[model samples]
Each structure stands twice: as C-alpha cells, then as structure tokens.
Target: MSVEPLQRSAVAKDEQWNLQHIYATAKQWEDDYRRAGSLIDQVAGYKDRIDSASALLAFLEQEEELGFLYEKLFVYASLKLDEDTRVTEHQARVDRARSLGVKISSATSFFRPYLLSLDKQTLDGYIAQEQGLEYFKKELYDQFKYKPHVLSKDKEEVLSQLGEVISAPKTIFGMINNADIQFGEVTNEQGEKVALTRGMYMRILEGRDRERRREAFKAYYKPYVGLKNTIASTLAASVKNNVLFSRMRGYDSPLHRSLFADDVPVSLYDNLLQTTREHIAPLHRYMAYRKQKLNVDELRLYDLSVPLVDDCEVSIPYEQAYETMLAGLAPLGGEYLDILRKAKTAGWIDVREKQGKRSGAYCWGPYGTHPYVLLNYNDTLDSMFTLAHEMGHALHSYLSDANQPRISAQYKIFVAEVASTVNETLLIRHLLKETTDEPFRRYLLNHFIDTIKGTFFSQVMFAEFEKLVHERAMNGEALTADAFSEIYEALFTAYNGELVALDPEVKYGWSRIPHFYNAFYVYKYATGIASAVSIAGRILEGDEETTKAYMTFLKSGGSEPPLELLRGVGVDLLKPEPIRDLLSLFDDLVRQLEEL
Candidate 1:
C-alpha cells in the first residue's frame, strides 16, 4: 500500500547522507556558489596568454582549481535539489550553479581553439619546455583528436553560453517526471484503493497476484499516457537539439558525436544493436518459459517482470541487506570491504526514500570527498542488488580519486559502468553459491537473467530506438507521440517476440526513460556487462592476476582512452567475442532453466 512519504525531517539523521561534509550549512553553500561565480568571471584572464608553455601551464592550473570548485558546488546543489525536488530554494541553487558553469564554458571556450591552432611539433616543444605540463600532457595531447570538431572561438563561445538553453528539455522533463507527474493509484492487497508510486509499482509488478500486477501496470502508466503529448514534446526537443549540435560539430550523426568523446566509432554502436537482435532467441525462449512457469496462457508485457518462480519474494531489511551485500562482495578482499563498511556507517549513503526525493539510485561525489549514493531504498532483494551496483560505482570513484589526478579521476561513461556491473556479477554469483534452497537458487538465477535482459537486451533495444528517433529527426521528419509509439511498439514486438501480448502502455516506454535525454549512453550498459561477464568470471575462478589487473583498471581512471583502458583489463569492445560469450552463456542458462 502507498503511504505518504515521510518528511525529510521525520527521517533519522543518520539515515540521510551527510551533506555537512560538503558544506556545513546552506549559508556556506551560497558562499561557495558566489566563489565559483567570481572565478567564472575571472576565467577570461588567460585569453591569449596561453600561447606560451609557461602561460598555458598557469592557465591549466587555474582552470583545474576552478573546475574542482565548480564540480563540488554543482554536485551539492544537484544533490540537495534531489533530496526534495519540490523545493524552489534548492532549484534556485542548481540554476545558479548551472549558469555559472555555462559562464565558465563560455569564458574558456577560446583555449581549445588556441591549443589546436598550434602545430603538433610546436605543441610537443611547449610540453617539453614546461615540467608542470607532465600532469596535463595527456589531456593536452588529447585535444588534437577533436581538431575536426572544434568550432571557431566565437562560435564555440556562443554555443557554450547556451548550456542552460541546451539543457532546457532535460530540465523540463525532470520537473515533469520527478515533481509534477503522478502515477494515479492501484487497488491494494485489501481491495482498498491506494495511491500508486514508482517504488510500489516496481514491487507490485513483480508480485504473484496477477490482478494487482495488471492494476499497477495501468496506474503506473496513467500519468505518462495522460500527458503523452507533453512528454513527447520534451523528448523530441532533446533529440532534435542533439541533432542540431551534432550537425554543428560536423559529426556524421548524433550517435557519432556522442561516441566521439571516448574515441569509439559508430560501428561499435551498430554492432551492439545488431548482435543483440541476432542472439535474441534466448530472450524469446525465456519469455515462453515465463509463460509456461507462471501458467499464464498469454504472457503480457507486465508479466515479463514477475519472477518465474513465484511466491519466492523475500524481505531484506536495510541493515540486513547491507550486511548481506558486504558478505556477497567479500570476494573483492578486505580493502574494498573496509571502504564499503565505512560508506554505510559514514554519511556517504542516503538510504531511504521519502517524499519529494529523487526516485532512482546513483553514486556521485566531488573530488577530495568520498562518493555519495542516493537510493530510494525499498528494502527488497532488488534494492539490495541496487546497493551493490551503486556501491560498485562508489568504490571505483574512491579508488580513482585516491590514485589519479583530478583530471583523470573522472572516468568516462563507457568504462564507468564496468565497476558497477562487476560488483553486481560477483554479488549474484556469491548469493547463488551460498544459497542452499533450490527454489531461491532458481529465483537467483531468474534474477541474473533479468539483469542480462534489462542491462543488455533492453538497453540495446533502447540504443536502436535512440538511433531511429535521431535519424528521423535528422531527416526532418515530424516527431510526435504517435510517431514515437509506432516505432517503439514495432521494436518492442520484434525484440520481445510476438508470443507475448502488447499493452497500450508498452509503446510509451520511451516516455519514461530519463536516460534518453542523455543521447547514445545506454549502449555502454550492454558493452559494460559483456566486459564484466569476463572480468567477474575470471575473478570468481580465483584468478589473482586478473583480480589485480582489474583493481589497477579501476585505479587507472580516465588516464587513457576508455577503449584502451578496457583492453588493458582484457575487454576489447572492438572484438565481438565478449558480447558473443555473454550471449552464449545466456543461451546456456535458458537451456538449464528448460531442464529444471
């Protein structure tokens, strides 16, 4: 049943994350906000003086300082706003921080163009002349990779200043999804009408009561279906805006524009989509298996999430869940375990979901501070896995921050999910190995299947959807709610198989995803899992050499190109073997399920 969320003050102090470590009070946050604004104003001081190696070194140093301050300030504002999205005060802070960020971008837009203006020989000479440049050498040399995409200084400045405008679509959607939209209500267990929520929807969808699941399916989509047009507009604006930027940057497509940052090619994106579709038979078989196991004559989209082994739901209290997570992840050794323990006890994690808080879980932190995780924890098995997943990100961040310079500590999104996925893989494997119950063992196996489906199959389907919408927008086709539904439904049927029935709400799946606003990002989840499957397997087999290499990979951070970094740990995305291996295991698991 959906009860009103507790007020922020109602929650115990320790249950909430310690924002005090970032800033003691709102007053201090404002002070840093102002400090960042002042620094943004002075960013123009390094204008033409960056031509010389010594001057460039000085400019880089100042830029790094400003970056450190801006990141911390922005993170605070964003996290504070997430705590209570309805609060206009936090919203104002986020707005001011974003505006200051735009100013910084606009002011420093000249540096890249100037740096690219010099010949490689001259740039190398400058790097050699300045000993301090060693720290920034990789970042500096990496600028040449973007020589083709770098716009003129004037153009770049104008574009940089429009950061707020460019982000408007995402910002509007955030408000709609988090604060404004409501998921109507569903019938509770007692047959009393109760308000529905995202957390409730997740649990109910997986519930054994088919009617409750059906009721929730409609209630959950009630808002999105009702406001389809508005969400469609926001999403369209985001896609078209990406198209505009991609064209302006002279990239082949928006996909290329996004992958360009990590030095990935369009082929990798296309390969993920194609390969997943080709190997989608096992997913179809799993759906059929679900239909058989659940004894439902016709499987519906809502039926997809309910565990095949029904009546296996287990409640894991937060403390119990945390302890279980620690036990599951103990394979990573003591150092990792020590940090994980500290994260739970320290103010690093916001554990419970309350009113107006952000709905999802993620790990984030500013440099020189421990990483923070925001979880709308519902104390379910899924919630426990989420804990493991997000903490994976935290451990990665902690290692990177401690080992690398600030510039490299921020790893790219491509390699970012690997650490998180590895933790999840190891955790699930540990649970499976330790569990003695046969049905729960099968339930765990089902959970792992869902992970592959969600993280790999579903993501690739989304990657394809993203590609199609962008291509449509690129071709000057009209983007509407109906148009999006048509494309989404067809893909849904194609990837999911027609053996299952479709719900009207299924097509509107594109509307609810916050990730679509950030273009071409989900494919990395598919790539990440493929890599993690390999890394986790090796580690599980007592491969110390691989474990050491994996830890080093986490510490390496953004020092090298993401692909090269993955290659060091034996995950080469350019090769299809890893993806193929993952898919083959998935096929084997389905056969095992068939036997069971």
Candidate 2:
C-alpha cells in the first residue's frame, strides 16, 4: 500500500511554513543578512568603552537591542531550515544564521571576561551607580560564576572553533540514521513481506505477529550492531568533549556542568534514576501481567508495544482529535480553548504524511508568526496523543512569546517537556472518563500504564546508562563497544528483573540512543513526566488555585529559574511526592489491568 501525499490546498500557503514566512522570499533574507552583517561591525563600539556608569548602561542596552533583532532574523532562518533540511536555499539561510551567531558571539565575548576582570568593590559600585544595570546583574553573575571554568580568551576562542567539528560524531550518527541506513524486510505470519525502515518499524513492532516483530527488531538493530565500533568512537568523542569542557570550566563532574547549564540541581537527576531503580518491582510485575494478559508464551522486546486488550481500537480522525483535544483542555478555560479552535480553523497543522517528508513531528515558528505543528496523523490512539502533545508545546511557545521579552521567551529544555506531558496527562484523563465500554476502558488503562513505564522508568534507565558511561570515560576508562554493551546489558537485566527474556541482541542498545550525546538530558523526560502527573491530577481534581499557578508558570517563560517556575505550579519536584504519585498511578493502572 502506498501512502498518499497530504492535501496542501486544505491549508494556507503560509501555514505550510515555507521560508517565505521568515521573509517574503529568499532574496529578502539575503538582503537582511547583509544588513545584519553591517550591524555586527557596529557592536564593536561597545566592546571596551564602558569606563563610566552611564556609558556602560547605554552600551548594554544597545547591545541587547541588537541581539534581539539578530535573534529574530536567526530564529526565522533556522526554523525554515528544520522544515526541509535538504533544501539548498534553506540550508544557506541556516548557514547564514550559524555564521552570524558565531560572529556576534565573538564580538560580544569580551563582555563576560571583562566583567570577571572587575574587582568585587568595583562591580558593586558600578551596580549601585546605575540601577538599570540590575536587570543584567544576574546574567553577569552567571558568567562570572564560571570564572573557575573559564579559560583564557584565546583558548576559549580556540574551543569555540573546535565546537563545530566536535558535533561531527553526532551529526554523522543522525545522517546515518535518518538519511543512509535502511532496515531489511521482515515476513509476516501471513506470508507477506513488509520492508522495514525507521518509519515503519513502529507500526511493525506493534503488529499482532510475534515472529514478525522479532524479525523486525533483529533487522533494525543488525546494522547498528555491525557498526558498533564506529558508533562507540563517536559516542566516546562526544562524552570526552563534555568531560574535558566540564573539567576545564571548574565543575566537579560532567553531570554537574550539564545540569548547571540548565540551572537544575544534580541531585534531582540522580534521584530520578535512583527512585526509578527502586521501583523496578512494579514495572516487572506489570510486564509479567502483560505477558499473561496477551497470552504470549514468551514476551520479547517487540511485545512491549502491542495493546493488551484487542477489539477496542481508538481510531480518531484529525478533526475529532482536535475537538477532543479542545474539550480535554477546556479546564484551561474559554480563552485557551478558543485559541485551540482558532488553530484548527486557521490550519495550524499539516495533518498527513507526505512523500520525502520528515519522520516524527514537531512545532516550529518565528516570533511574529503563531506556532505551526506537523504530524503524519496515522489515526492511532498514540497519534492522537502526539497531536495533543505537540499542541501543548506550540501553545506554550505561543503564550510565552506573546507575553515575555525575546531574551526570556524561550524556556530551557529542562522545563520544556512539562507542557507537552501535561497535555498528554489531561488527554488520558478525559478519555478514561469519557468511555463507558469496559474493555475499552481496560485498554486505555493499560495504555496509561505503558506511558508511565515507557516515559518514567525506561527513560530513567537510559539516564542511568548515560551517567555510567560518562563517569567511566571521565575516570580514564575506555568506552569500547563491548564495554558500553556490558554496561547497558547490566541496566536492562536489573530493570527487567526477570519479567521477560533479555535477548543477547539487546546488548547493542547503547548504539541507538541519541540522547547520550546530549548529556544529562534523558532524566528530564522522567522528571518532567512525574511533575506533569502531579499538575494534571490537581487540575483534573478541580483545583482552581493549581490551574492558575500552572497558567502563570507557562507565561513566566525563562524569567525565573526552572525549579522556581515548576514550584509556582504546585509541583514540588524537589520532594519525592511527584515520583511517588507517578508510581502510584502506574500501580493503579496495573491493578485495573489485572481486574480486566
């Protein structure tokens, strides 16, 4: 069966978000590029001319204004580039942004070193002389706080130059995964052969044919395993880069450096993995129950995605999904729902899979334009949930961009996952309550359980694996492919706890996770989901105060620290309640599945 191209006429030309939205056309972007380059030379005037307090304040304000203008142009170009990465023109625009960013970064690089050079009394006197300087006091302090980590300006510049090449390993991995590697065909039980690729892997993995799923898993990982050494080298280089940078910058460890960038406490990340490890019994018990419920003699990796209860397919069309999403989020009040309805009517979504299109989904936009979401819309229950999830991000960006300054508009990745998972949490609650059929309810309950297991426990396991590998490399231990495999195998065995067979093939799991290159990122997915469960439960329970606080958190953007933002939403993520509540939800879902 061939997948048909999505109808683009159904949506506005601008809704598709071609590069024209960034500028009316490519030529305009080029012209702006030249204008921006000229402005870069002007920024040099502020470099070393801040002797007086008034001069310093004027220079700082002017520098920020220039930065905002440059960012507006850069974001537009970069967002356009992400849409169709292969397009030469869009790539040119993206290259322009990167080049300009580096140039501007170099130009402004003196600000931090210069500030750090000032003595405490001199800095305090300057701060007092110009009260307006207080707005940037925190920003200045952040830069100086890393003085122990900051190298000489010349060395830092050399490191900055090395940054682009340092990304090659991960970029190579992405190219191999997205553009080059292909999965071989696996035959179904019906004697039909289906070609396997990353796109089709999920659908195949979810098939009723256990043998086909097994073959699919093997075929998918075979290439990865063959190239394990190369992958290991790339990963080692990336992790080594992190360790080197952290140690150079005066951090105790790479993990500390990574978390410090996002202003997150390292303990929060450590606790997420530790708590998840402690609760492995629940995950194991759920997996055991799933094996029996599905009546499989052996539960393999492929069996993880299959629905426990059949005959209860929740096939939702794009429109119905939109309505359900609107209704599901009505607790957000009329204004929020109206914005959603407008998104639906205004063609904010590109709602079908098309030829030569990107796999997966995302939300993208520049400042002036509202956010646009792209989805393949396969009509599965998970697809609907994804629609709800991406919309959560789009709406968050919309609200934050609307209310905050450009510098503060973009939230950190630490807090970025919360809005999307909160949307998922609300959508699940709505469906569980809206349905009356017992079997369907049971299936939905099972689905919710899988969400918790996959998001919280599985990601936390990955985080543990990531932490171990980094620690090993930091300790002068080699990160050979076999060593990596052994570490992951240990984690899998420990977390699985005999629920299912840990296939020897599963040892190559480290080759497949891209987040390891990202450094200390996967744990946030677990922590974010836990935090969302708390926030969503409160809103679902008609806690008006919590709802208001959550809305405030969304609008607050990066104005405060990530923890402060989350705390405002009534989720004490520092405490253990959110994690315990998440585990309780998983336990309840398991009990429901048992009854079913």
Candidate 2 per-residue C-alpha lDDT over 405-481 given as tens digits, one digit per residue, 9 for 90 to 100: 76677888888989999998899889888988888788788778878878888888898988898899888999899
lDDT (C-alpha, whole model) for all candidates:
0.87, 0.80
Q: lDDT of model 1 at residue 558? A: 93
TM-scores for candidates 1 onward, in order:
0.83, 0.88
User: Mind giving the per-residue lDDT tens digits that candidate 1 earns over 1-596?
Assistant: 12367888988777789988889898887787777777766668878777688898888888888899989899999999999999999999899889888889988877877888887899889889999998998898778778778788789878878989999999999999999988877898788899998889999988888989998999888899999999999999999999998899899989989888789989888777777777889888988888888898789988988878755568788899888888887767888899888888789999888889998899999999889999877767888889999999999999999999898888988888899999888888888889888888888788788889888899888999999999999999999999999999999999989888988799999899999999888888899999998888888888888888898998888988988888888777886778888998788777866776
Each candidate: RMSD = 4.4, 3.5
